[model samples]
Target: MTEPAAYLPVLQTGRWFAHLPPDFAQPLLAMAHLRQLAPGEVLFLRGDAPCGLYAVVRGAINISGTGGRADEARAAMLTRLEPPHWFGEISVFDNSARTHDAHAAEASTLLQIPHEPLQAWLTAHPQHWHALALLLTDKLRTAFVAIEELALLPAGQRLARRLVMMAEGYGQWTAEGQSRRVIGISQEQLSLMLAISRQTTNQILKDLEARALVRVHRGEVEILDLAALRATCY
Candidate 1:
């Protein structure tokens, strides 16, 4: 049997995996299958049948949606995920089709725990099901907060809050060190997530830069002061 200890260090950077019981974590990592993706590759499309749960080991996964409409705005980019975020658990519970499109925003590595094997394991250890549900609930909490931001916050404040949120890995950041300081995202991608114009995103980023709250690079934003970034949400 493969030892879970071999994989634990990297996976432990993600809060969800770190919290799993020894019995649960051991088998899950042992059963996990790996896949590599080329940049721009489609991992899964909206409406596809659920396959399994996935954890991002490296690189970014872009979660997005496409609606069949003449309107250009019908296509929306949601969030970009990096290690060691886990996703696709919603369909695992409900046995439903995928709710959004997932693509490799860059060359990416993933560890997937397939539907059948995971179900078999869960049947024997039903107590660990709560651990799985916690993953879904964490996402729900983020969604609720996002909804509130969209309705009440101005574009600038919202963008600042988003920078802070992304920097913190949407609360999945349990890793120590510099991983949390650099957010690998482009301004255009940020605009898509916020449903704002690229020009607006550029201007907002510039304003934040002027205040020394962040340093924007070609394809990333480094948080110079995460606390000040959060304060802008007001």
Candidate 2:
């Protein structure tokens, strides 16, 4: 049998895998399957069987909900998952159809483990139950934050919060101390995630840029004042 390392880096770094009971490791590792996805490719659709969870190994994945009109502003949030981030987990736990569609935001590698084997392994390793519970708890917290953003925040505020969140979550230092360069993500994509019209999103971006809080480049967005940007998260 191929070892875990022989499959992909994602399974090796997954929080769920890392926290699994020692006894469950070998079995879980043995069943891991790896696949590479091209940019713009769909890993799985929303209604696919709630099989194994997926761990991102390289590149990014965007998770979007199903059943939204293209122009209705259903607010398809882009998760921007990095290595070790798991998706499709809720479906795996609940044994329901996948509630969201996951796609490669860039050329990516992923590890998938079948639900049947994972569940069987979990059954024998009751010690892992607490870890699973904690994982679910974190997911719930994030979901609540998303709900709050959608329900309470105005369009500009929602957009501001997302920019700050993305910058804090993914930006790298630019040696200017105050300036940090964010990864290449288009405004259209951000607009889709924010569930606002492209014109509205563009206007918000301009306003932030004018305030000297951010700088939008060809594809990258640079943070000039983290504190000021965060303050806009009202």
The backbone clash count of each candidate, in order, is 0, 0
Model 2 CA deviation exceeding 4 Å by range: 1-30, 68-75, 170-180
In Å, residue 224's CA in model 1 sits off its true spot by: 1.7
Q: lDDT tens digits, residues 1-234, model 1?
A: 433345567789888989889999988988888878999999999899988999988798999987765665476788998888999998889889999999998999888899889888999999999999999999999999999999999999999989888887887967653337888899989998998999999999999999999999999999999887888888
TM-score of 1: 0.93
lDDT per residue for candidate 2 within 21-133, as digits (tens), equals: 66666665577787789998988777888778676777888887744576764656556776666666687578888877888988988777788888887788767767667
The CA lDDT of each predicted structure is 0.88, 0.71
Reference-based TM-score of each model:
0.93, 0.79
Query: Poorest 10 consecutive residues of model 2 by lDDT?
Result: 170-179
Q: Give the C-alpha lDDT of model 2.
A: 0.71
